[model samples]
Target chain A: MALLEVTNLSITFGGLRAVDNFNLTMEKGELYGLIGPNGAGKTTVFNLLTGVYKADEGLIKLDGLDITGHRTAEIDRDGIARTFQNIRLFKDLPVIDNVKVGLHNQFNYSTAESMLHCGRYHKVEKEMDEEAMKLLGVFDLDKERDYLSANLPYGKQRKLEIARAMATKPKLLLLDEPAAGMNPNETAELMETIQLIRDKFDMTILLIEHDMKLVSGICEKLTVLNFGRILAHGDTKDVLANPEVIKAYIGE
Target chain B: MRKTQKKTLITYAIVIIAYIILEIFMKAGMMSSHLKGLLVPMVYYAIAAVALNLCVGILGELSLGHAGFMCVGAFSSAIVSQLLSGAIPDALRFILALIIGVVISALFGMLIGIPVLRLNGDYLAIVTLAFGEIIKNILNSIYLGVDSAGVHLSLKSQMALGLADDGKVLINGAMGITGTPQDSNFTIAIVVLLISLFIVQNMIDSRDGRAIMSIRDNRIASESVGINITKYKMTGFVVSAAIAGAAGVLFSHNIATMQATSQYFGYNVSIMILVYVVLGGIGNIRGSVIAACILYLLPELLRGLNKYRMLIYSIVLIVMMIINWSPALRDKRDKLRKKLMKGAGHGAA
Candidate 1:
């Protein structure tokens, strides 16, 4: 059985069919990729999956449980996490604190316990601080953990977004155009980082990327979307070499 | 151990010293009783402003109907205290009164939060404003008096039931809620303010608080992280309402009297609460309280200009806002932070 099963999910934005009959299913530990031209509704599918908008029609299942219309955070607690297409770190807060925000559900202490700094409070707080720092170190951001998130350079900000998502301890992670503005070397580094994160965490991943080279290299399976429809889906090599996908992209 | 530590200690010391001086002035004949009466309102208003800050500033919800919850607390506790004053032990009655007040306010807080919490930004504001008006209208219709064989149907009407005379309005219509035990004052006000501060501060710093902030900062990003944005936002709204309700208890008793709900519940009070948060810098709790006191107290000192006091106050406020919120001043402030920080380490290492 797949880790996530999405079928017939659709959304319309005022006569624009942003997502129509979108479907995806991925096995545990699989690294999958989504590719499309601009305005192909790649991000819209992601938005639907994350529950940012209610789907006009669809059935979504995670581990055999119906999760359609569930709120995003509830979906996250059900073991899916995603980095945004645009980096959305809590700008004014320190880096480690950003990761700590993801650890919201894990703490057992009450508000009273935290304020009083009582026995359980100190223990839980120390563990969270340590955990947040560990995630930061994984992204080579331990030294920069005290700086405000917005002060960090762009590449570091992207890394912090991934690190913050990892703090949620998800079983499946989604990356929305993780390589959008990166130069060649930074793109290569991010590809390597994503692989390391998946292996270390033993998590499944579904990512949307515009860079065919990076997506083809890392993903085992690939799905090509165009105009709210799946152009192709198969092993990455098979889908990448498809005549339809190339025609849709090259417009020849 | 560090400069921030030393500075914080000194700031606290100065505030305590100032408080001591104010107490002495009160003891001396220099300050009139009327002026001294302002103390409770000052403290209570500050509490309400800060509580509003938690909703509007930290949670980023525009809640206009705080006075509705405040009314529930004020009237509920007033009735309880008045009813039990003669029958219960003096010390117990006071404690019971406060507890009942807080509980009533919290219940209303939860109740109102359920509906209004779903509305966003301006919609939420409009709904809450309507809710406040509804509460005021309801309070006007409550007939607390009954006439017959010395039995009253309800607490508000029991006074009428107890009255053995003709033509006396017991808890009269729109005359105002009278006979509230005037037990709340400066000492209790201060204690409640500190408690409110401590609560709001910890909440914003906690994981749930961060969740609320995350939604405010980025709704889509927050949802993708698997946060129930609605739950978190509603939690913030309800907790903030509870604080407002508690402040209402403080406001109700300190006045020791009220004529109409309109006297306290109005559009200006909401704006005043918002003003405190904005002037102090939106997310800074301590700064907000300081701003509340400055805005509230500063006008009173200019007594000779009483006729145009509000006008002058408005002018000063407008000028201050242009200076403080002016992007030019903010840019300079950022530069100043970078300069000062270059001289020292960021935190306790």
Candidate 2:
């Protein structure tokens, strides 16, 4: 069975269909790319998948569990984690603390224990610190772990966000425009980090991007979307070469 | 030790050392009675300020109803101490009263938090403001007494209570509760303040504290990451209210009369606590302690200056705000610190 399966996912805003009859299936450990022109319902699809918005109609299944119309937190607990396009982070917190917040459910202690710093509180906190540092080390953020997240350089901030997402231990990860504002060098580094995340954490990733270099460099399967409909779907090389997909990118 | 732990330890040490110095002064008769009388009140207000900071600074919610929670604690503990007054030993009765006060306040926190926490920003603040006023009004009109016929309550005149001759009036409408045991002292107040600081500081360094702060930072991202928003918000708010209630207990026991008055539990008092949280530097627990102490004591200390007292107070408020917040000033201060440190390093070399 596939790690994620969606059938006929649809949503409408007023008279316009934001996402219409969108269907997707992904196997475990796949590096999938979702590409489209601006406002082709790509982020809307992400919102629906993560339960930010209830789908007008659809069946969303992850690891064979039907998770349609669940709340965002519930869907995350069911194993889909994502990064935002605008890079939402706990800016006042230290870098490692941001990831520890992501690991909230994994290590549990009662409110009383937390307030008093007794019982399992110390043990769990130490474990969380070690684990968060380990994840930060992967992104090369361990040294800057004590710095408030807002103070990090832009490229490092993006990496920290991805690190925070990985702390949740999700089965499938979603990256929304991972290289939205990066220089070529940073974009190249992000591409390597995306691949490293997949290889090291055994993560399955689906990312949306406008940067063709990063997209073509890493994505194995490609799906081109335009006007909320699939323009082309196939292996990366074949889909990129399709005249229909090319037309959608640079109109006829 | 971690940086946060070291900072927390320093806060504790400061409070303890101050307590010892004050005790020595009081015992040696070096402090005036008028000045000494303000001690417990000062500490309790500091405790309330700490609680408000947790709600406003850490949870990132603006609340103007904390005085209502404090009112709840004060009235409830007063009634308990009045009823239990001769039935138990003084110390034990006070402890029980404090416990009951805290529990009841926490329950009220949970109840009020359910509806108030749903609103955001100004709406939340407005609703809480209304809540504080409502609690004060309700408590003002209530007349409660205990007798062999169990407890008697009346919103009408105290006479409408129709208590038996032996019945003791716990609360007499607007007159409020009087003759309650005075069980609070400076030592107890300082102890409670330190404990409140410890709890809030520890919680901030824990997973739950991180969750609360994450919600404050980005609600949607926290939700996307599987953090339960309502649960965490409620947790921070209720704990904050509970701590305020503890402060209330200290307040009621420190005075001879416990009245639900606008002077004590009104919107202005709530705003005053917020000022402490803001002026102390939001999200800075130790700052709350120091701010509450200095700001609360300042007016009284300047009593000899009478007319100019408030003027100086307002000027100090403005100065503290700039020192804590103005970015240009902060940059300059940071540079000055670096320069001083560099000189010290050269001297050591």
* Model number with the top TM-score: 2
Model 1 Cα displacement at A239 (Å)?
A: 2.8
Q: Please tell me the TM-score of chain B in candidate 2 relative to the true structure's chain B.
A: 0.95
Per-residue CA lDDT of model 1 for B1-349, tens digit only, reads 5332354445345445656776889878778786677777777777777778888877787877777767777777776776776898866877786678777777776776777676655677887787778777766756454234443433355454465454223345566577777888677777777777767766766667777887777676666666677778877777777777777788777765564467686655666777877887676666666777778777886677889898988887887677568999889988997878776665633
Alpha-carbon shift of residue B20 in model 2 (angstroms): 1.3
Candidate 1's DockQ is 0.57
A96-145, model 2: which lDDT tens digit per residue? 89999999989999999989999999899999999999999899999999
TM-score of every prediction relative to native: 0.88, 0.98
Over B185-275, each residue of candidate 2 has an lDDT whose tens digit, in order, gives: 9998988899999999999999899999999999999999999988999999899998999999998998887789989999999999999
lDDT over C-alpha atoms for residue A184 of model 1: 94
lDDT of 1 by residue, A1-252 (tens): 988999999889999998889999999999999999999999888778777789999999988889899888788888878898888988877787788888877766765664444557768877988988888888999999779899998888999999888888888888999998999999999998999998888879999999988998899999999999999999998887889999999988
How far out, in Å, is residue A85 in model 1?
1.6
Task: For model 2, name the residue pairs that clash.
Answer: none
